[model samples]
Structure formats: structure tokens, C-alpha cells
Target: SKFRQADFNLDPLWQIRFDRPLGYFAEILSTIGILGFLAYLILVLVALNKAMILKTEILIFPLLAMLIGQAYYYQNTTSSFIFWFWLAMIAGLCSKIKENKISFILNKETLRGRIMAFVGIIVISLISLFGIFFISRVCFADYFYKQSSKKSVGEEKIVLLKKAILINPYFSGYYITLSQAFLNNALSESQKPVKDNQKIFKLVVEATNSANKATQLSPNWVMTWQTLGMIYQEVLGLVVGVEDWGIKSFEKAIALEPTNPVFYSKLGKIYFAKHELDKAKEQFIKARALKPDFSELQFFMSLIKEEQGDIKGAIKSLERLQVFYPLDLDIIFQLGRLYFNQGETDKAIIQFQNVLEINPNHLDGLYSMALALEKKGDRAEALAYIKKALALSPENQILEKKFEDLKN
Candidate 1:
């Protein structure tokens, strides 16, 4: 992480989780610690030794070669499956090779040994039964969790999720989902014609509690903090101290994932909402450094420039972005509006035309095109463009007044 470059921490996900690492050895060292790695090596060595005892040692080279191939690049998924399958096959072959050497003769001399074997078998059987019971509980919890996902009705979904939590309360994912569910319910309750403040408060509280529980259960998991951050952010003004809570949540997420640009960007948004422009700009600058090429970051930077009354700076930032994302409708539209603001009507018309060329049916583009054309004294063309916009959005009061004004 110390030596991680521009997208340093993200490299692990792309290098290993999303793709393969330098080799299976590197992967093993990263995923499994030294103990598990040593166990894997021991298994291979014992298997190689058994192959020698069975006089089938020649087959070991191909198996080693297959593993070595994966060291650099995967041969295929089948080759990986074959590697483990071959290990099992070799172990079975060795077992059959030694089958006739030992006999279970229970005579007076071996009675004590046989009884000890029987006791060991009972212990193994009990362990297997316990494992089955544990697995069955997990299966039931997962089944309920999956059912909850397919449900559209909020109450049904909540019931299924609660049932899943009942079965496996330790799973952080269940609490995360429950937290989100409660948040969604709260939003829905607020939007109703007759809002129930008490119900909304209860839902919001439940959402926070569930999110907190998730963080407690899997304190190290980045998603838990992120989810908690979102839950707190949503109820910022509706509930007291949630602005501070949201800030704290995003701060925790940043501490855990310092290189991730998204947390910085979102934290900046919260600051922007609070009108702390300098704080917002600082966060955006950090995010831009981490991920300079992302269009969203550029948009944020341009927005900050606009908010700070550096209209020319905003336009300059957007012009550079235009070179990269020529088809981004919003960026193009914004550039045209900025040019129009500076009384560069001709440049604005060119951008509006570009927008219309890309999306002929765009209402905003059509309306903006009419205004730009009207500014240039092209009355007939402007009228025609406004008509097109009006036809698209007949219910818009602004369009109606503009059309009536043009007619007069």
C-alpha cells in the first residue's frame, strides 16, 4: 500500500480478485497465509512420494508442469480442476495399493486397540453430524436471504430478511440489507400523501441500528462502513447529529480505503451541500489526484469552479474534458450554456448543434438551440426549434411562455 501508485490499493482487486496475480504462488501467499501454503505444499509432496512408492512417479511431472503453467498464466479452468482431481485420484490409488496390507482382526490381543478405534469412529461421526447441522442452518439462512431479494413488497422482504437474521444473525450482509430496506421504507413513508412521522422515525432508527450492527459484526469489512455512511447520510437533516454521523462514517471509510476516490468524492458532496466550498474543493482535489481521468471527478471539479464564481475556469476544465468525452451530453450542454453566458453565441450554437446532432429529440438541447439561434437573429430557425421543443414537452410552462413570446 505504501508503494501503491495512482490507483495503488485498487491494484490488488484488479490484479487478484478480478484477474490473476503474477503467479499462483503469489496468489497463495496473499490469499492463504504461510501455514495454509505449507499445508498445500505438504499435500503435493506426500502425493509425489506416494506416486514413487506405487511406481507411477512419471505422472508427477505433468501435474507439476500444470501447476507451474498456472504460476504465470492459467492453462484453462479445466486444467485447475484436473490438478485437484489428479490429487484425489492419486490418493485413492495409493489407498487401494495398501488395502491388503492391514486387516481388522478383532482377537483378545487386539480387543483394546479395536475398542479405541471404535471410540475414534464415534467421535468422527459426532463431528460430521455437527457439521451437517451447521451447514443446514447456513443453507436455510441463505435460502431466506435469496427469497428476500426476489420480493418487491417491503413487508414481505423485511419478514424474510428478519427470518434470515434469526437463522444467521452473525452475517453482516443480512444486517446491511436490512438497514437498506429500512431506509427505503422510511423514504417511501415520507413521500406518501399522509406522512406518518412516528413510523418514519422508527424506520430511520431501525436503519441506523441495523447498519451499526453490521459494522460491529464485520468491523474490518469496507462495505460495512460504506453502508453505515450511506444510512447516516440519507437522514442527515431529518434526524439530529446525522450530519456529524455521516461525516464520521465517510471519514472511517476513507481511513480504511484511503486510495479510493469515491469516498473522497462523496465526502466532498456533503461539504458542498453544507456550503463549505474550500473543504469540498480540498476533497475533490484529493479525489482527482487518485483518479484524474474519471469523468465524474472532472464534473465535480468543474462544479466547484462554477460554485466559486470562476466561470472561465469551469469552462476551461470542461473544454479539456470535451477533448476526451466528446459524446457526453451533459458536459457538452454545460459548455454551450457557459459560452452563451460569456456572450459567445456562435460558439454556443456550435455546441448546441453538436448536442442536437447526437440527440435530436433532447428537449433541453432543442430549447437551448432555439435560444442561441434567436440570439443570432435567425427568427425563422429559432421559431422552428422552439416548436420542436414544445411538441416534445407540451406540458412545460417555460416552453409554453417562450413559444407565446416568440409568436408575438
Candidate 2:
């Protein structure tokens, strides 16, 4: 009762205040619990003979408390075992404190005082352990709380920047460089969104503008120019697809870092968007040569080959893709489409069947299979498949029209 209320609530255990206001009794209970744990922990340490010196025994309680709390947080292990273990430690310490006080009070003379002094040592040992535990837990929680909070804010900024990039794209150096700031903002909450959306937008705009300025300040830094181009293409709402600034940016990046696979990939994306099969293929090939496992580049290469009527070449690229991503439905569907395009209805049907096997309700597979069956003159089965496809995508005008045409 003589203990400060602040001291009572500072317990490592029995202080989980979740509901409304915590009453006075709760605080007393928590304090008692912690003290009890400290006492037991002290006894265990003494029994084990791990006590180095008198000072070290006193220090162990706090150290143990901090260690246990940190280990729980680190492992994210909020199990009952951890909870009870901590509770028991605090209880043991408190019990030891009570026992020492009783023993000291019963005899204060030479024999009694000597006994009291020994008991005092035990109480002090427990107290020291609790102190160490509290200090360590506080310090660790403070440092980690700040770090995790900062990281969370930074991640939010990155997501916002990514969304901004998706929104407009095709502006200039401004938008492109904003992406970098978004990356930095992702590093720290201080650079992230505050309470206001307008402020965040303003910050994003400023970042983009800064990137544009950086390009002007260091025109030779091809990356700066390339970033500027992405802003124009992705953030600025420019009319030009990758063909306009994208091509220029990729070319500039190539001039500076000719062997960079990313530059080649960007150029390939530009060419692909423009339906420039030959050019896209060339750039995609170069990118693949530099980084063979770049699946998107490989996909682009397949796209170019398909567009160029090179069925065999497309199939080879797609086969390699299948090896890399066997479960990708889009790739499977694309492979099926290639077979259908090349008058290989049976092969196309097989691919479509594969898609259905992976996902029975796949509308794309149902539609493709129906078309393939129709081409093979299985009119009845085709009609059934088309009806199922129509059911899956009711609002699809093309599918509806095809379904009607098949019926006719």
C-alpha cells in the first residue's frame, strides 16, 4: 500500500489494461503479481548457483523480464506458455520479497538481524532483477516501436506513389523522379503522408518536379532522363505511349548504359505497345540474353513471334515459360490461342482442357474450348460449351453474339 501507484502499473506482467479504466485493485494485483514472480526467479537463480556476485544477483530479475518480453515479441509467439512463464516469474519475485520482509521483521537483534540481512539480500537480488528487466524492456520497446512505425509509414508512401504512377503516366522527369521519392518515403514515415491527402499530393508533385530538376541539373545521368520519361509515360498523363518518350528514354539510357538489360526491356515494351514486332523482338532478345530468367521479356518475345506468324518460335518461347510458370492460366490460354491461330484445333482443345483441369469454372477456357470444338465440327458439344461460357460471362457482348451465332 505504501508503494507508488506508478510503480504498481510499471509491472512487466499483470498490467494488461484492455478494457475501460483500470481500478485501483487491478494495479495492486499487478504489483503483487510482479513481486511474487521476482521472488521465485531470485530463488531459482540462487539455487542454480549462477549468481556471480551480490550485485549480479540483484540485476538478474530485470534482465530476465526484458529478455522474456523481447523474445516473445521477436518470435511473435503470443502463446499461453510464454504468458504464464512471465506471470510465474513476477509472482515468484513478489513472494520472495514478502518472505524476506517477514523474516527480517520477526528478528532484528544479532541473530535475527543477521537472518534479516540474509533475507534482505534475497529481496535486493529480486529487486535488482526486476529493475534490469524493466529498463531493458523499455529501451528495446522504445527503439523498435519507432523503427516499426517509421517502416509502416514508408511502406504507405511507396503504395501511394505506385498508385500515382498507375493513374496518369506519361508526363515527364517530374513523375518519374517522384517514384524514387516514393521509394525514399517508403524508407521513413517522416517523408510519408500526413493527415492531409492534399499535402501528400503536393509532396508527390514536388518529388516529381525535383526529379525533373535533377534531370536538368545532371542531363548526362541517363537514369535521370529515363526516370523523367517514365513520369511522362506513367504519371504525367501524356498522350504518348512508350513509343514517344519511352523510346527516347530507353535510347538515352542505352547510350549511357548500353549493356543494361532494363533499358532493353523498356525499349522492348515500347516497341511491343506500338505493335512493332521486329523491333520489339530484337530488344526483348537482347534483354533475355542479358537476363535469361526475365519472364516478362520472354513473354514479349513470344508475343512478337506470334504476331509475326512464327508459330514454332512462339511455341518454343511459351514452352520455356511453361517450365518457369507451369500454373499460369494466362500463359496456358495464350498457348491455346496460338495453337488455334495456327489451325491446330486438337492442340488448342488440349490446352483449353488443361486450363479447365486447373480451374473448372474458367470462362476463358470454356469459350476457347467451344471455339476449338466448333472449328473441329463438333457443333453440339461446341454449343454446350458456348452456353456455359455465356453463363460465366453474361455481360460479354462478344460471347453473347458468338453464342447466338452458334445457335443460328
Candidate 3:
């Protein structure tokens, strides 16, 4: 559940069909309903039918065998078509087995019988047309949603998402993506020098509403609740008691997927935000028990340890995680910070070296490298690193002060 969450680094449209079904009897039942399920069952019965009375009945086995293969490996359009086409073939064979007894009920021998048959045909035609209309609308909505994903960001993306929702408001994924887009806009607005309180407030409300809509649309989906919790958590101060709402959302997600390590880790982060360190640790421990090698969970555990002033313990956790996520910039940089905090200057410098090698432009890595270098009594090299850091963030007071100290 956790691993399937959308990657923020990629465009949302590119992530379409991540939630699509890979084929299952339940999927067919859900998509096509009871009638479809019965149709599939009819095929199974046909395949197993031992009665050799009708030679035409043998025609079904070939298609049934093909459908059996498709049902297991399906996610393809062609396979889906074959599934329904096979059902149609079965219906065709049934018609050849006998004449419709319903024709006798409306024999067309009199005016009343003729009128009844005419009405029946009209009703069936109308139903077929309506089914076509409803299905086409859904298909077009999905098409618009896919189109939205191709746009990088901004108004075009937002407009396309809104259009998709307008066409099919019942889809939870649309609401989730829309909520994320709104939150991104709100975050961008907050970072600007001149804050537009009214505009940002609107975006925040839209984000919260969209996330809430997603949960309503698919309450059982763990990812929807996780997305909702994230939205509420991000807008904590902007909306009153949002942190509590966030906790509830994550708790709901955890309830739905108790064994998922990431769910517990998310709930732990919410508790961590509320300064409930003990509760956070409890959640993290549960996560660890479920998945001992969960690197993300381990990373969060190290954070809790770091927050409690256990520098060595934090470093140990990150070091163990580094063995697995060798090139993880965040883990390497954090390990460097913890080593520096523990007064292990040389170790901190080496860790920083590793971080810089992976991500040379890492601002924190450069600044922390300078700090580690200065602590190791190499003011000259440290000053050079400090200047390098200052070039990146000239307005940063900490860097400016360090630069002046080195210059003077």
C-alpha cells in the first residue's frame, strides 16, 4: 500500500493506471456487476460441460481456454475485449440451441401482440443507447484525466483535473490528484516574499476539500486516507485542529492495513508532529516488528532518537540504514550531522564527503561540511567551504556571519 503511493518527483499523469486492476474474478464482478459475473460463470460451466449432444458446443471450449489465459494475465485492452467477446459467443451458441419462447408470448398474430413486441424492442433499444452513453462518458473522463497528467503543472493541469472530475466526480483518484495539486499551489504561495493570504487560504480550503472528497469516494482505500492525512498535516496551522484530523486519517489508514509498515510510520510521524514522542516510538516499533528492514521506518526512528538527544544512537541507526541505501543523500547528510553532534568531526567530514559526491549542490551538505572542517582545526579549508556555501545562499544569515568570521 505504501510503496504504491504516487511519486512527487514525477508527473501525476505519468502515474495513471498504477491503481488499475491486473485481472481477477472479483475485478470482473466489480466492473461488470452480477450479470458479468454470471456470464463468466456460464463460460466456466461450458468448458466443463461433458454433454456431447451438440457438436456446436465444442466451439466454445477454444474461446473459453483463451479467456482462461487472459483472465490471469489481463490488464491489456485486447484481453478485456476478448473477455466480453467470449461471453457474446456463448450467448450466440445459446440462441442456436432453441428458439426464444418469449416470441410466442408476443406472437404478432394480432394487433395487441404486435404492439407488445414493438414496445419491447423500443425499451431494449433505449436501454442499450443509455448504456452506451454512460460508458462513453466514463471513457472520456478517463481520457481527460490522462491528458491532465501530461501537463507539467500550473493552470493547465488543474483545469484538466477539474474537467475529469466534472465528467466523473465519483472517482477517488481524481480527487487525490486534485488535492495534491492544490496543496502544491498553497506551498508555492507561502514561499513567496509577499504572501497573498486570501489566495493561499482559498487554495488551502480547496486542497482540504479535495482530500476529504477522496476519502468519501473511497473510504476503504488506504492510500486515499493516507493522502487525506498528509493534506491535513500539511495545513495544520492553517486549519484549526488539523493535526488531530490528520491523526484520525492516518489511524483510519492503519486500521485498514494494520500490517503495512509505512502506515504505522505515517501515523508515527503525525504523533511526532504533535510532540508525542512515546506514542511515535510505539508506532515505529510496531512498524519495525512488521518489516525489520524498512529503511524509511528506520530513518524515522533515527529522527526520534536524534530529537531525544541520543546522537550516538541516531548515528548508529543511520549507519545501519546507509548500508542498505548507500547512495541516499538524505541518510548520508543526516549521518554527517549526527556525527558532528557527537563530536566525531572526522567521521562527519567523511560522511559529508560522501553526500557532496552524490549531490554536489546539496546546500545543507556544503554548510555542514564547512562546520565539520572548522571543528577539525582546518580554518583555511573550512573558510573556503563556507565561501562556497555562501555563494549558494548569500542571504542566509548563518552563512553570511560564518563568511565574515572567516574573512576577518
Candidate 4:
């Protein structure tokens, strides 16, 4: 009974210790499972060889079961490898059976066996060719879809996405993306003085149709409904009555995904456009509660405040936003205008200065700064700032008049 173990002399490698003992047990079981799987594979291979020799196809059932098991266990691995391996094995077996049959037929009657072999080869070749073409179409469609995202030019992106849709019309995302591109192009065209109303209208119509198609194809998808709502509100609104359609689409989106703040914001914007200030405020408040850091929601909240004739409330909202986005020129300029309206000339001038510091060539900022200086009895500096703004926009008749008046 008398042999004592020397624990102090044991090396770290010799110690059988596990911080997570269950993990160690699991790893050991996994190793044992793998070994068992290897043994099963060897037995199946042996059975397959024996079946082949006996000209019995019964072993195919067990082989297929093994394939199913492998697929289930290794779903994330390269499935193509398994597919090709199984295909090759089946091909080899079929060829072997054909060879044996051909040999037996040729021994009895050579001409019939030769003709059958030729027909079989031609049929297989045709099937393979069709398979390749179908697969290539799918692959090319996926490639174009990916390439569309990499394109910086809107037209090029639209072309690539269209090609993808042409190849794979079942994919709803392609139509949605193409709709967005058309919307962007239409917006760009609308801003030009030499606008093609017909062309813009056609673009908007196409965007609307595409967006509608996407929604129809994926009726349950919230994003598709949201996209359709955007198309109705932003693009179709330029040509037709959009309130009902836009509201319905957005409501559908909200129904599908009630927590999406963007959908609520979009609904609020529609109400805002209709001058339904209370409804707009309700939606905006809900959006703000859901996404407190969202700049657009905050900006819209300030607009609502201003529209409600609460200038001080609007100013406070913007000031709160400035704490998060201090360098934003739009916020700075809006804050300056609010301050000027409240007769806080000094604060207004400081905000305007901040805007000019961020963007020296800002036309509105320069003109506003000049007005603020003039209000403060700094006529010379005000004139200087106006001159700078005039130089930047020399073709503006309004600025030219302002400059002349200031000089007089």
C-alpha cells in the first residue's frame, strides 16, 4: 500500500488538469466520433467494391445516406467539392457498367453496341452543354449584381443592375436598386434650368413602376414597402397625387416593421408637407424616442418647432443638436438665423463667423455675415463681406443690388 506519488516532480505536460473539464470530455468524444466515422467510411468503400464486383447496385443507397450525413455535418464547407466527388464516382461506376455491357454486346453483336454508344455520348454531351450555359447565366448575373455596387457613376450602376435583372428577373432587390438609381437621375435632371419635364416624368414613372414591381414581388418584405413609399413620396409626388399612395405604402412598411424609425420619419414628412403639424410632431416625437442620435429627426423636429411659431423652441432644439454635430455648417447657419431673428446680434454674428471659418466660399454665409455686421453698425466690414459674396456669385442680380445699396 506504500508507494507515494511525487507531485512536485511532475512536469506541467504530465499533469492531467483541465480548467473546463467538460470541454476536455467533449473534445475526447469528438475525437472518438471522428475515428468511428473514418472506420465507417472504410467499411462503406469495401462494401461498394464488393457490390461493384457482384454487379449489384444496392450499395448506392448506403453511399447516398453517407453523402446526406456529410452534407448535414459540414454544411458550411465547400459543397461543390462534395458534389463533384459524388458525380465523378457515379460517372465512373456508370462507365464501368457500360463497358461491361458493351463488351458483352460486342462479343455477340458489334454494330448495335457501337451505335448505342455513339448516341449515348452525343446525348450526354448535349445535356452537359445546356447545364454549362444555364450555370454561366446565373454566375454572370451574380457578377453584374456585385459590380453594380462598385460603380460610382449612377448611370453605370443602373446599367449593371439592369443587366442583372435581365439575367435574373426573379430577384426583387435588382428592381429596387434600379428604382433608386432612376430616382437619383430624375432628381438631378429636375434641378437643371433646362429641364426635360417629359424625360423627368418618364424617369419617375419608370422608378415608380420598378418600385411597385419590387413590392409586388416581395410583398412581405418591409424594405420593399418602404422603397415603394419613398418612390411615391419623392418621385411620383412631382407628377401625381401622392398623399394616399405614399401613406398607404409607409403604413404597410410600419405594419411589417413597427420599430423602424425611418418609416415613422417618412410618414411624418408627408404630414409635414400637408401642413398637418400635430400629426407630423407625433410621428417625429416617436422617431426621436426610438433614435435619439438621428440628425435628420432632430433637424425635422426643429423645423416643426419653427413652423409652430416657437422660434425659441426651434433655437433650443438646434443648440442641443450642435452639441453632437458642432462642425455642421447647416446647423450653424440655421442657429445664426434664429439668433438674428431673436435680436441676439452678437450670438448670430459668432455663429455666422463659425460658418465662414468652416467654408470661406459659402455664399449665403458671407451675405448673412455682412447683414449681421451692418446691423451692428460696422458698415465698412459689412460692405467688405458683401463684396466677397458678390464676387463669388457675380451673376446674381439680387447680390448686385445689395452691393449697390450698401455702397450708396
Q: State which candidate has the highest TM-score.
A: 3
**Candidate No. with top lDDT:** 1
* Candidate 1 to truth, TM: 0.62
lDDT of 4 by residue, 39-85 (tens): 65565566566557756565466556655655344332245445445
Candidate lDDT (C-alpha), each: 0.82, 0.63, 0.78, 0.78
lDDT of 1 by residue, 1-408 (tens): 213345553453522223346677667867798988888889888998898888775577877786677668634445666788788778877885233454544332598758877887899899889967877888899999999999864888999999999998999999999999999999887766457889999999999999999999988676788888888778766777676677788888888767777778888877876778899889988987887655777877797899889999999999999999999998999999999989999999999999999999888899999998888988788889989987776667898888887888
lDDT of 1 at 226: 85
RMSD (CA, Å), each prediction: 7.5, 19.5, 6.3, 13.6
- Residue 75: error of model 1 in Å? 16
Candidate 3 lDDT tens digits, 1-408 = 434432421443432423545656657876799999898787667643522234555555666576567567554655665656665655555554234866566778978889998999999899889977877778888999999888764778889999999988999999999989888888887765456878888998898899999898898887789888888878776666677888899899877766566667878887888889999999999977766666777898898988998877888889889998999888998898887888888888999999889888778888899888877778889898888777766667889898788777
- The TM-score between candidate 3 and the true structure equals 0.73
Off by over 4 Å in 2: 1-242, 252-259, 356-366, 377-395
Model 2 per-residue lDDT at 114: 77
Candidate scoring better on TM-score of 2 and 4: 4
Segments in model 4 whose C-alpha atoms lie over 4 Å from true places: 1-133, 189-202, 231-244, 359-367, 370-408
Q: Residue-wise lDDT of candidate 2 within 1-408, one digit each (tens)?
A: 112233323344422323211442243346568677566456545533443433345545654565455433332223434544554554454444455556556556668777878998999999889866765654454444334334434455444444434443332333444556553452332222233445545545555565666666666666576675555444322233425756776677677656556678878777777777788888988877766666778777787877887889998889889888988887888999998988988989988999999998888799889999999998889999888876666667888888888898
